[model samples]
Target: MRIRKDYMGFAFLLFLAAANHWLLIPGQVLAEGSETFYPYLLNTALVILLPCYAWEIWRSRGRNDAPLFWEPGLADLGRILCLLGGIWLWADAMKHLGFILPTAFFLALCGWLYGEKSVRKLALLALVSPFVLYALFTMLGAALPQGGIEIWLSPLLVR
Candidate 1:
């Protein structure tokens, strides 16, 4: 009997879920609080959801006959490569430039690459999102890498 392509993908996801619970989460030395809660919750959710996904895949196996992966055209491939390169540059830039600037720049570049033509909207998104994220993560007790701007702003942002 031939196994469906969707089943293979499901199996890969199942393996990742198992790895997350058994291999990844076990190694983390979590503090006494909700830090441990999220990972276990994620694992539990995956345990519940993967079966449902598998069932859906099995139930609709006959209806779908798509290939294992879609082939992207040259333009699509170029866009994907540019996005990846942008991500790499963003990460490197973050060390020197700080979270907000690099993130804003990356967001703007991504927006342009992904066909967001409105400069005002892109600027708003690029500028506002990093600050929002920085504030959110700060409130959540996550330590992000800091540069001059972050160092200057930390007094106000961090409690």
Candidate 2:
């Protein structure tokens, strides 16, 4: 049977959730009844994202709206190439520039890719997105993903 793409994504997400929980099982609870916060947080995030995904799967089960997966035809490989190349460059530059600059560029470029064409909108997105991340990490103590950006940016942004 040809499986629906949404099902495949859901399965992949479930597998990741399982893997995350398995990896953290030994750490979250101690034999002496102490608890580690890191694993608990990780497992919580994994579990949390699943329901949103499940809700999407339920909502989209019957509708033929836009394509679930963007299949860009033959010449569409160019976008893939650009995407990978940009990611590579972003990784290489992370140590020097930090997350904010590169992430802004990446976000704006992606918006452009999806046909967004307003300079004001792009500027706003590129600026506001990073601050939103910083706020989330600072206020909520959320574990934000980083490559090497923190090495340079942290000293300037945080005490």
Candidate 3:
């Protein structure tokens, strides 16, 4: 039974869920007195989905018969480079600039690529999303990134 690429994604994700549950269950949850069935839940997910994915992939393998590889064009390379540049810029901005700056910058870059034309609208989104997200999560409850970037932005964010 040959495996298809799409089903491969399912398999890998199921593997990840199973792996994490096994590791975290004994390490984090077991130490406490909680009697949660997180491990059983993960095991059920694995047992149910993995065989189904494998069966589907096997059935579809010869039926689909798609091309083995579609080589990346120059535009694909350029887009990847642009994404890399954005990540590099984000890392630098996190250190020197506030989270608001790099985040908005990334959002603006992505939003523009997604075909936003109105400068005013883009600017509003670029600027407002971070605050909205911060407020929505911070006020309503969610964790925010506070990595080494925190040290660099401390003076600006703190004051």
Highest TM-score, which number?
1
What C-alpha lDDT do the candidate models reach, one value each?
0.78, 0.67, 0.63
Q: TM-score of the candidate numbered 2?
A: 0.59
Task: Give each model a TM-score.
Answer: 0.61, 0.59, 0.44
Q: lDDT: which is higher, 1 or 2? A: 1
Please give the lDDT score for candidate 2: 0.67
Candidate order by decreasing lDDT: 1, 2, 3
Candidate 2 deviant stretches above 4 angstroms: 1-43, 64-70, 139-159
For candidate 3, give the lDDT of residue 52.
Answer: 83
Residue-by-residue lDDT tens digits, candidate 3, 38-153 = 45564677777777876766666666473243355677568769877997888677656656667888888877765788898889998899767654433432334444544454
Cα RMSD to native, each candidate?
Answer: 6.2, 6.6, 9.3
Q: Sort by TM-score, best first: what order?
A: 1, 2, 3
Best by lDDT: 1
